[model samples]
Target: MERSKTVRKGTAYWILGVFAIIWAVITLYPFIVTIFSSLKTNDEILGSMLNLPRDPVWHNYYVAITGAKTLHTIMNSIFLAVCSTAGVLLFGSMLAYVISRKKHKYNKIIFTIFLTGIVLPIYATLVPMMKMISKIDILQPNAFYTLILIYIAICLPEGLFIMAGYMRGISRELDEAAIIDGCNTPQLFFRILLPISKPALATSAIITFLACYNEMIFALLFITDKAKYTVSIGLLYFVGKKTTDMGPMFAAIILTTLPMLVFYMLFQEKIQSGLTAGAVKG
Candidate 1:
């Protein structure tokens, strides 16, 4: 009976491993196709997308970098994403710490407000935001700064949600012990809580950065200056009125996607931990 049970478990494990491989193939199929497509000519891609390039056109990457100026747009995205993500993490974690630790009558109300923000669709605010930006001359000077602020505002709710949940799982005994050791609020927060919250912070940063990097509608509408285009807006340059440059476009996408892929790969473990955080009470 024991041997039979062990065989059953082994069979289940084999089935799960096979299913995982199949799922991974399904998930990576399009990305693999795009990478191959980037190396092929437009004609070759159209003829056989599933086939590997007969002779890889490395020049397509050159066209994407030089003609489309993809590197410039990537730099712009990095700046915006970094700045906005910093803002979201700083403010969100501070607010989360307070809401999670402190006792206040308005705590629930504030949490509710942030929860509502999570529920609200950012696209719905585009018109009103555009009108507001139009009226505010200070916001008009630098579109990047404006968009950074907008990204922070929109990302804060989700950041707070993640951070606050994680923070709540932390023991209040830490806070009390820190106070007993003569540490002030700021030190307790910065040195104690923040350090322990690495997984949550990494999780928040990844999500916030992705939102800022991939945001298109606001970037397109708010930023009229071609020089300030984000990666999402820059991709549109390949589409012309008379002709669409498919080869260069696919190359540009691959170039733009690499950084984000690397980032996720680096922090994937932390992100997983953060997602499962707050599940068990300590």
Candidate 2:
């Protein structure tokens, strides 16, 4: 009987291994092609997509970084993403803490509103938002602050939801202890609650930052100035009215994608732990 069980388990492992290999190839093949194509000339790329390059052009990277708007766009993306993530973390956590801890009559109503935000599609509101912003004059020409505000609004719902769920798991006894020790609301939050909620906060931060980093449609619609464009928008500039520069475009693509890949690799373990820790308790 034991031998039969062992054979079944081995068969299961083999099946899973085959599936894993196929999945990896499906995901990684495009990235491999992009990297290899970036190292070839436009003529070589046009001649044959599958053939190896006759001579690898390492100058693509140099031109992408120095000759194009790659560096400026990268900085813009990082700045917007960082600022928006910070805003979401700060205001979202505060709102969650209040809703979770307070026993006011309106707490349930406020929670319902936040939950509604999660269900609503952002694209549905874009036209109304554009009209309102245009009327308010805040959507002035070349303003990045407008984009930042939009990011904060879009990210707040998920940030608050995650934080509220995490806060539910924290002990109420800790709040009572802090109150007895004469700690004010800010002190209780910053010193005690925020410190304890690091895992959940990190998870929210990563998600918010990535969202802002990759946002394209709104950036394309709202931003017109070349100087204010993010990496996502800047990449589209590689395609001209007449022709597309495939080599430098791929090089730019690789550069834009590498940072996010590195970031995910660094925080992937922590994100998994955060998700499981908040969900499961002894």
Candidate 3:
């Protein structure tokens, strides 16, 4: 009976291992195609996507970076993502801390209001928001600030949910200890709580950054200047009315995807732990 059970367990392991390999191949196939396409001529891509490049067209990358201004747009995306993420983390964490720790009659109501923002479709408000942006003199000069504020608002609800859960898990005695040490509320938050909430903050930051980085519709609507275009907007340069530069476009996509792929690979562990810890503690 023991030998039979052992054989069954080994068979199950082999089946799972085979499934895992198949899934990995399915997930990675598109990326492999993109990389191969980037190195091929337009004719080569149209001829056969799976076939290796006849002679790698290294110039495609050069055209993508210079002709399409890929690097400049990537920089624009980075700036927007970093600034918006910072604002979301600051405001979201403050609100989360208050609602989670403070004794207040209206805490639940306030949280529900923010939660409503999550459920409400962003498309429903786009027309009104566009009109509002046009009327505001401050936003007329630069769309970056406008985009940052919008990202912060959109990301805040989810950030609050994650942070509040994590904060609730923390012992209230820490707050008392800080108070006894003559630390003010700001000090307690900045010095004690924020440091302890690194995992939750990291999770929120990653999500907010990626959202702002990849967001195209709002960027396309708000930004008119070519110089201010984000990576999503920049990718459109390869598409022309007459003929699309498929090779250069594929190269541009590869360049754009590399940074985000590297980022997620680095922080994937933190993301999992943060969600797990927050869920358990809350």
Candidate 4:
């Protein structure tokens, strides 16, 4: 009977594994097709949707990179993502630390306010955001960074949520010890807590960076100049009212997605650690 039970368990495990594999392939099928399609000619792609490339058109990459101004768009995305992530990490973590450590009415009020952002759809604020920005005359197509504050504002509340949850799991004894060591508030936050909270910070950084990188609606509404476009906006190069260019478009998409794919592959362990940080109390 025990042997029969063990065999049943093994069979169940095999079935689950097979299901997982099928799910993975199903999800990854589109990306695989996109990668292969990018290596085909426009006619070949339309002609042979599922067939492997007979003669790979590697020049599609060069065309996408040069013709679409991929470098400038990628650079813009990188700069915006990096700066926005930095701000989110520093400000969000500190705010979380303060709110978690102090049990006060105003802190609760602040925390509640930040929580509201998670429920709020950004589209609801678009009209108001535009109206408010229009009143300020500093906006320019070249000065796209005038949108940095908006990015930070959109990012901060979510970052604060992750950080505040993580920070709560941290013991007050550490803060007391830091105080005992003659550490000031800034020193305690910057020197000790920040390093210890790396998992949460990394999680927030990656999420915030992805959001800032892939954001299109804001970029579209705020920016009009092709020279100042992000990779998301750069996607328009292959699209037209009448027809869409397939090969170069797919190539650009693959190129655009590569950075994110590489980033996740590199830091996957850190991200996993951060995600499972609260599973066990240290």
lDDT of 1 at 237: 61
Assess every candidate by TM-score.
0.85, 0.90, 0.90, 0.88
Give the local distance difference test score of model 3: 0.87
Query: What's the lDDT of the predicted structure labeled candidate 2?
Result: 0.84
lDDT of 2 by residue, 1-282 (tens): 999988987989799999999999999988888888889998988887687777889888888887777878889999999999999999999998998887889989988887788777788988887787778875774588898888998888888878888898999999999999999999999999999988779878877888899998788878888888898888887756334557877889899998888887888887666545433420
Prediction 1 TM-score vs. true: 0.85
Q: Model 1: per-residue lDDT, tens digit, 1-282?
A: 999988988989789999999999999999999999899887888889899988989999999889888998999999999999999999999999999999999999999898788777778998888899999889983478898888899889888888888899999999999999999999999999999998789888877787788888888888778788889889876556334557788899999998888977887776555445422211
- Provide the overall lDDT of each model, using Cα atoms, as 2-decimal numbers: 0.86, 0.84, 0.87, 0.82
Candidate 1: stretches off by over 4 Å = 1-22, 237-244, 272-282
* Candidate order by decreasing TM-score: 2, 3, 4, 1
Q: After superposition, how far is residue 16 of candidate 3 from its true place, in Å?
A: 3.8
Clashes of each: 0, 0, 0, 0
Q: Judging by TM-score, tell me the better candidate of 1 and 2.
A: 2
Where is model 3 more than 4 Å wrong at Cα?
Answer: 1-5, 9-13, 236-244, 272-282
Provide the lDDT at 33 for model 2.
Answer: 85
Candidate order by lDDT, highest to lowest?
Answer: 3, 1, 2, 4
How does residue 153 of candidate 1 score in lDDT?
Answer: 91
